[model samples]
Target: MSQPQQSTVRNRLLKALTPSDFALLQPHLELVATELRQPLIKPNEPVKQLYFPEVGFSSITTQGSGGKVEIGIIGREGLVGVIPLLLGSDRTPHDHFVQGPGEMLAISSQAFCGAVNESASLHKLLLRFTQVQYVQTAQTAFVNASYQIEVRLARWLLMCHDRLDGDELRLTHEFLSMMLGTQRTSATLAVQALEGHRFIKAQRGRVTILDREALENLADDGYGLPEAEYARLIEGA
Candidate 1:
């Protein structure tokens, strides 16, 4: 790839690569558009491609008889399919799906695994990202367990805002329910509470952030720890 082409890569994991490491994987990288709610990796299915999102976010979710709840969010800052690749397994326990519309750079899992095996730095960086993702998942569990519905909703909104380019998020109540592992009525009530506080505005299928500071305040400690860890581990790469 040309210098300018490499320079234009937006995924943080790709951007963190040393020139030599990047060169090793460059030929295999394919930029592709992704649609909202598209499944990048399905549960128990072999991961054919590892995705590094450039412009949107993907949700790592676990499902049950009840439904699915998001455990982690992956965006420009992280890569999907790391667990399966690291484990030398082709399938993952969780499902990964695009939560918003955007583009990503994808590499076939076999190619990515080959590059990782050959590059110590790349291996270490990806391992560090896995750690960061673990923190995010653990924090999500903490937030869901300890926080109020409104507070959890605020924290979730902040997460989406961090990943997306703008304040407006095109999300439905049904989707919010799925992400939060709550009933739609409960999600609607939480949305109303945030709207009442002027922290956000919710329409039929979208929510617009009006006051991020207030939303953060509402979320309190539920939102910052994992984010700080990600910055500490990934941003420095």
Candidate 2:
């Protein structure tokens, strides 16, 4: 099969910009492909460019005395690295890594700041996206604390499938375990359970959702809705 097209026709945020406003920043927005399992930004590193994902998703993961856990994820639904731009944050609080392969429009920190400063519309749009992202971060915390492992696993798979626009996903059990903050054996068992239900099919490293509705039902109440809310807020903003 031929390679998927890795160019942006109109990213959600970019499309929201007035034609003239988009024109001002278009030259600075460089298109790049995200490699599987690659770290876009590391912990404690300086924030460089702002990435607006045109496809796939990136995980903002935090690590400490306990272990690593994904705090937030961004796809075409939102942009990455907005905290530094909004708060003047210099040190990275988490690692930013691509969870799946996709296209992104990247702009230098200087250029991004300039774009936000020059266009009031752009500023408002980005800030609204920021608010939605904050909600997601909060919900993820709740899920981590209160939800069962199977529920969380189902939620994560639904999320990955949503952003990729396909059921088939390229990810490893090790990676899934890290994202969910679960033991490898537990994660393996969760995958097995989903497979048995015919909600998903798992191989060595990848997973393909078989019945999306059943998977959504299995996620209980901690998933799906938050992502839908993010989309609505962005659309109405």
Candidate 3:
């Protein structure tokens, strides 16, 4: 079947596509609006689609008897469906949810597997992406274990800022509580503390960075690694 003319969507990865690569998968690339708080994959559910986020953040979470905690966040630097691609697994042990709103390039799992099998460039890219995910998982564990809540929040905001390419973030404290595996009261307190230090300005659902340099100083050492890795992986792509 003939592929459609390449899409001109705003997704960084989609836009970076070479003409030949874009044409080869143009018919399969469906542009979809990713909604915040939407569940991309249920825990322990079948992996049916691979999402290439163009402008949003998706959180990979592991749930316990208490609640869910975010283990990693993926944006334009990586793909969302790594289970099927790397382990040949059909199901996801973790839940995938959208943390921010933006456009995504979503393709079916079968199509993704086919593309990987057919294209050496794609296979290599996916493998490198798998490595990035590993790094994020490790860093998240380090952050949760060794860092204070305020520092962790700074790191989180910095990571989000790096992806969003802006200083302002639209989010609610309630959702952030879930992401951080903390109580809502705790989250509120953290936000207030950050605000007091002029690291962020929080009003209603929006939080704007006031002094990133100070935040970076407070973010601890592990925080900068992911930001640097993102720069190396996706800058100018």
Q: Find the candidate with the highest TM-score and give its number.
A: 1
Q: Candidate 2, after superposition: displacement of residue 229 in Å? A: 2.8
Instruction: Please give, for residues 1-237, the per-residue lDDT of candidate 1 as tens digits.
Output: 433256888888788888888898888888889999999999998899999899998999998899898888998888988877886788988999999889988889989999999999989888888888888889999999999899999999999999899899999999999999899999999999999988999889999999999999999999998889877887862
Clashing pairs in 2: none
lDDT of each: 0.89, 0.80, 0.78
Off by over 4 Å in 1: 1-4
- Give candidates' CA RMSD values in order: 1.6, 3.4, 2.8
Superior candidate under TM-score, 2 versus 3: 2
| Steric clash pairs (candidate 3) | none
> lDDT, candidate 3, residue 133?
74
Better of 1 and 2 by TM-score: 1
Candidate 3 lDDT over residue span 1-237, tens digit each: 443344645555555456666655667877678998788877777888888787887988898887888888888766787655567778878889888788778888888777767777666555656766778889999988998788888888888886785788988898788778788888899999999998899999899999989888998695877556554664433
Candidate 3 weakest lDDT stretch, 10 residues: 1-10
**Candidate 3 wrong stretches, greater than 4 Å:** 1-19, 233-237
**Which candidate, 1 or 2, has the higher lDDT?**
1
Instruction: Output the worst ten-in-a-row residue range by lDDT, candidate 1.
Output: 1-10
